[model samples]
Target: MSDLDASTPRIFLARHGETEWTKNGRYTGTTDLELTHHGIKQVKGTAIQLVGPGKLIDPGRIAHIWVSPRKRALQTFSLLFNNSSSSIGDGTTIAKTKVTITEDIAEWDYGDYEGLLVGEIRAGRKKRGLDSETAWNIWRDGCEGGESAEQVTERLDRLISEIREIQEPYMNGGNAVDVVLVAHGLILRAFAKRWLNYPIDSPLPLMFSPGAIGILSYKNHDIDEPGFYLGMALPLQD
Candidate 1:
């Protein structure tokens, strides 16, 4: 068995590939969009680099996959597992991995700010006599008429609890059991913060690029000590 299998379980957070809105810097919450041609290639490349036997994300070890309800995230999941014939692994790993489409991992609801760029949002807020002196910060001010940081924290905390429950059993020496979350950029960043017990409203320097993957795991193989992986070596093949 690989050393990773004997260590703490991990959560693989995958951001969906680029869309026209994403590339153009628009807030994409609740506005379901498809991936562009380039986006498809990006995810396929990530799969080749990360998802396979003896790779960072060996799909056979993934216990559960929580995907956003949006089509973009769904497309990413399909491409990552080679369901679209992108050909990363043998294509049988997904069949054994449990996948769920959930709103819990969806992007932060941008509401009135949906489809608008950051500058546009700020201008609109100023026109409406909101935040006239200060610029708009989604993490602190949140989107107008949309969810707040506290609300996002509530939902994410609940989902984190669920993920912990799933991983607790196999955390100690056993078969590798990991969880995968396919979602949007902002929310995934927020999720990472929450995983480390950090407030979502805090200054977040985390940057999750399009089609990027981030790993979260317990430190020192202790479930009580959650931490993010800055870098990890590949598991040794038996």
Candidate 2:
């Protein structure tokens, strides 16, 4: 059993809201795009859910809020936590506490096919008997100039290590420490894979709709022998 399995902490992962490429099903890696109007509403909606009853995360108690350096992610983080009027007045406000930007949390590098649509890529690959399924799953086989699932796993592992350092100071405290991460789709899924202890190369059976949120926490009663608990909220389509 790895150390992550032993001291798993509660974390909230929020995928950045929709972008032009996202709505059109293009490979949106590394490219910085703004949130559509609907995307903005989704972020605010998720924020409201977090701030309401039965879900209130005490601002004063949150351990850390990490965000991807991408413009979209940074903007989402700002909109979510920068509202002083909506703040609970307990923990550090968004403006006061700079949400740490982590490169490890950025989207997967899509390489040669960065802006291409799935169908377009598939049609071209089909000329050589390759199809969409075979290509999109390229992470398993490795894509040209793109990071493989194994490489992404390495980055996710590093992020988990950083989380451990944060836990060292709070081990004795009975209170729960919460972390919120504003990141990209693939990176957020990578984090999920880490939390679940899944093989990164294993089929990405998981899908994160834009603006969706997930909770990573322990399920078992025993802290010494903790179990991973994953809760996913589907992104609103309409």
Candidate 3:
């Protein structure tokens, strides 16, 4: 952004709000679902508090936006931008950036485990002897019919490359330039890892909550340096 101190291009990763499955601790993907009422309210509040003139994220600074094809993710994006209107409270307007539905940022395709809870999946695997001493983890074992962590990493890396190609110049273009991605929890966490050039096999320090917001930027206004974790907006309790 023009007002920002550095030329580092900032990325805003907005995790989609809560869904029925998420509320119940299920692995939701592929089977598109809508946000819960509280989820809608969460994202709307996030919008009003973070995006606007002179806010934490200036709407005018956004240059590109990518949203998941899933309905929940799209709904979250809608709620984020629909915080207000003419003569409304706070009057936060949506960014003019074109929103693209990207498969790259879509939730990790949970496939066979789409509607199953983690505990259930693990118990099933243990029952079938598919798992032994270790509990099931998507980052490594992945779903039987779903994408692996390596596959997810590949896709996210490609997306990051493209984002850099498009936003690098804009970052140095001497004007406001930030990118926004609205997607699911796991995928966005994977994205954060890849954004920081971390190996997919590494343990992630944090898990994103539904309707969470995290930022990624260069450590020193230089892309060659490691990416920095700026901060998050409205972090949910574990």
The weakest ten consecutive residues by lDDT in model 1 span 83-92
What is the Å distance of residue 108 in model 3 from its true position? Answer: 0.4
Off by over 4 Å in 3: 1-6, 85-97, 170-173, 230-238
* Residue-wise C-alpha lDDT for candidate 3, range 166-235, written one tens digit per residue: 7666545576668889998888888888887888767967678778788887664566654756544432
lDDT tens digits, residues 60-142, model 2? 44678888888889878876776422365344464445368888888888777689876776666677676645555655654
Q: What's the distance in Å from true for residue 181, model 3?
A: 0.6
- Number of clashes found in candidate 3: 0
Q: TM-scores across all candidates?
A: 0.92, 0.79, 0.87
Prediction 3 global C-alpha lDDT: 0.77
- How many clashes (backbone N, Cα, C below 3 Å) per candidate? 0, 3, 0
lDDT of 1 by residue, 1-238 (tens): 5545446899999999999998899999999899999999899889877887667787767789899999999999989986433343354467633888899999999989999988999888888898977788988888778999888999999999999988888777476679899999999999999999998988869988999999999977788999998977776645
Name the best candidate (by lDDT).
Answer: 1
Which scores better on lDDT, 1 or 2?
A: 1
The best candidate in terms of TM-score: 1
